[model samples]
Target: MIRRWIAVAVALSLVGCGEDPPASPGRFGEVTSAVVLVNPVINQGSTTSVATGGERSGVEFQAEDLTVATDSTGMALVEDLPTGTVTLDFDPGTYSFQVVREKELYDVVLAYRDGTVQPLFPPVRYPLGGEVVEVEPGESIAEAAASDDTIVLLKEGTYPGNLELRAEGVLIFGAWSPTRGPLSVIEGNVTVLGGGNRMRGVKVTGRLTSNANTFSAAFSDIASATITGNGVTLLRNRFTAGQATVPSSNAVLVDNTGIP
Candidate 1:
């Protein structure tokens, strides 16, 4: 799937955070090269620019999707996040951000004059601008998995046995926390029959199988998994079933354990 990511370029004055103090935390750096959420409240797709420092600063990143994933649901991210590092120069402030694609909280860092980067933790949510579909506890993930161009979030709870995902262009996510609150578990086999299926932040205690469809997962746990198709990408996940050779394709495996 094509990765659609949104980014921001903001001057110091127009940036502010809700539900927290708005003052510039402290002035410590000449340039802060960090990722930030600038003017997240505004819809940037139609608005090309905003006034900053008495000048019209054109919007650098355009939001591709308007539906944003709210809360920690496994809902699809509003935009395709660009991978790798982004550099932003800014003055010291109490800033916070969130990455939509990665579905994780964001941190605002301070850059010192001596080139030291200090990240301010306690991250907050920044909407990627998309429609959010809420999945309550004990809800079936089938509809969310079958949808396209929507964000699906499963509240912290255990789901029923096994899930069959045959849809294309959908993301069903679970709560992502180190504490693992709302610990989510799929008790049965997860079968993917379509292409561009992505899974993250959940534990599949049963077997994971896929046809010759394109699949991707990150930071997930799989018991014993098998694949019959190509275009499978697994990153930073653990598979107890170890590795198996597909008849016709090779998997794009990165930072995954017990998979060859």
Candidate 2:
């Protein structure tokens, strides 16, 4: 009887000594939030320049698989960003941004954020001829005639001649006097320079592009023209015609005067 009791006690002790089940592992914590800021400027006029904010004041933020958030102060807060380097994309405009990690702060000037960095300066001005270059009525000139090297100066007179620019280059139509009228008509790829100029009387039978160089025109008439290529900017330029078409190859740069 005594031996049996001792065996039973030993069995109970062994059962108690068995290892307990392992505790479950804890989960990862949530990621912290980040913020960015953007500011843009819109210019309107010729000799006089002004900076004002309109209904078009807004910045777009792009990240991989993440939607960015912005506040009234132009601060963009990025959520759910993993613990690694992140790339942010923005529109074509000037931006002042700051990156903060813990208590450390980083200041940066971002003109563009994507695959490359573009210059922040506006388009370079190409001077028109001191004397206007007049084209006679019913005259036709080829791209070779209007050499890409020269800036054709249109005089303040009726030019019934047709101008053609076949090669890739800039055609600057500037006036010595601010009061001088704009180009009456263009038949090829050209950049009209000067503000408050009118293109209502002008007719474009070929491709036409503006580098946002700030030229004025009252009426614009385009026919089967593709406004494509780099540095093709248009700033407050009006277009009017009986029939006009914008080709898929054509692109317009707004408020961008960068060199091609």
Q: Tell me the whole-model lDDT of each prediction, alpha carbons only.
A: 0.43, 0.31
Over 4 Å off in model 1, which ranges?
A: 1-85, 88-131, 179-182, 241-250
Instruction: Please give the TM-score that candidate 1 achieves against the real structure.
Output: 0.50
Q: What tens-digit string does per-residue lDDT give for candidate 1 at 17-118?
A: 121111111110112222232322111111213221211122122223232222221111123333333333332222223334332322231212232323
Top lDDT prediction, candidate number:
1
Please report, as a residue range, the 10-residue window in candidate 1 with the lowest summed lDDT. 21-30
- lDDT per residue for candidate 2 within 1-260, as digits (tens), equals 00111211322332364722111110001122333433323222222122223222244657556655444533354555443454565543332222222211121112333324332223222222122122333343232234333323232233333343342333333222212223344544544332222232244545454333223221233443333222333432333332222222223322312112
CA displacement after TM-score superposition, residue 51 of candidate 2 (Å) = 11
